[model samples]
Target: MKLSDYAKSQGISYRTAWHWWKQGLLKGHQLPNGTIIIDVDSSNHIRETACIYVRVPSVEDQDDLDRQANRLTEIALAKGYGVKRVVKEVASGLNDHRKQLISLLKNADYTVLMIANKDHLTLFGSDYLIILLDQLGKKVEIIEDINNQSEDLVPEFMAALRIFSQKIYGKSMTKLQVSHLLSEFQKQFAPEEH
Candidate 1:
């Protein structure tokens, strides 16, 4: 189809479609006379459109977030995935109300979600999200998975305990009390050394 027709079919501006083509995101070519053609009938065209997601724990990590997004974009392009959009957020992985992440999950325009790490999506419940995305006919590409490192568990557990303690006891629980509780909980549940 013509580029204009493809743009109209996708309900996007001609300039946006043109930019996608210029960026090598659209599978198409231009003729000598300047007419652009798009291969809308390709079997895996829509399935290859990817949305890159990157997140940082705080606003202070803005540079790290940018680096993550850039790295993910490079990976996606190298894998021949069409870069549809890049969503960046400065929120803790334990945060459940990340608006950008939620919006991206809801949007069906992209078939793949690319991230530098699994925890970039969430520190907890990430497996559930991956399973849900798979059931929805979508894919998640993790560039580097350091999730299995035992050292990462302590901080995540502390954060989770802090949040739960705050919710259960409101704002009245002291840091000392939370720490004591965490120690007791660990003593009861920690695996025994052989």
Candidate 2:
């Protein structure tokens, strides 16, 4: 089929198909006439294998990651995906080059990479992660913790920031300290109001 027809068949826009083609993510080939042909059967090998990646910045949180990841595993397994293994990161998500994450994306065995939240994956440039996952024919699954105090995005984000900061600094933050931290985080992450 032609590229536009193939994109229509795949339920994606022609531009998206073209972007995938440029990224080498679409399983397709170019003919001598400069037309693209998609290998409809090329992606059948992508079985849903779950590989959980947990981020806990301190020894205090390290002990709890297993329980959290196990809970995530239960959800994945319930969905019929085979559990691969849980990978951990002890560094700040603001840092771009994480060893375990880099290695895992290079790996082609798993169809899914599960994490507690997008924040647990990276503090910024999450689209980059998604694009990389797409190229590798994998996906990221986020399991929100049910026990969390708030369901609202801003409060939950601030709470997560507090937890990571405590682990990074190796000390419990005072209420006032958290207030200051939240202020700075908002300044950096959220646009200033005035």
lDDT of 2 at 118: 74
lDDT for position 107 in model 2: 78
lDDT of 2 at 29: 87
Model 2 spans with C-alpha error above 4 angstroms = 1-46, 146-194
lDDT of 2 by residue, 1-194 (tens): 57787666544357756766677766778999988877666461224777888876445456657877778866875565656667877665665677998887777777888888776777678768878887878888778675541332444455567767788886767656877988886679886578
Off by over 4 Å in 1: 1-47, 145-194
User: How do the residues 4-88 of candidate 1 rate in per-residue lDDT, one tens digit apiece?
Assistant: 9876655445886787789877888889999999987764143377899987765555887788887787777667666788899
Against the hidden true structure, what lDDT does model 2 obtain? 0.69
Best by TM-score: 1
Provide TM-scores for the models.
0.62, 0.52
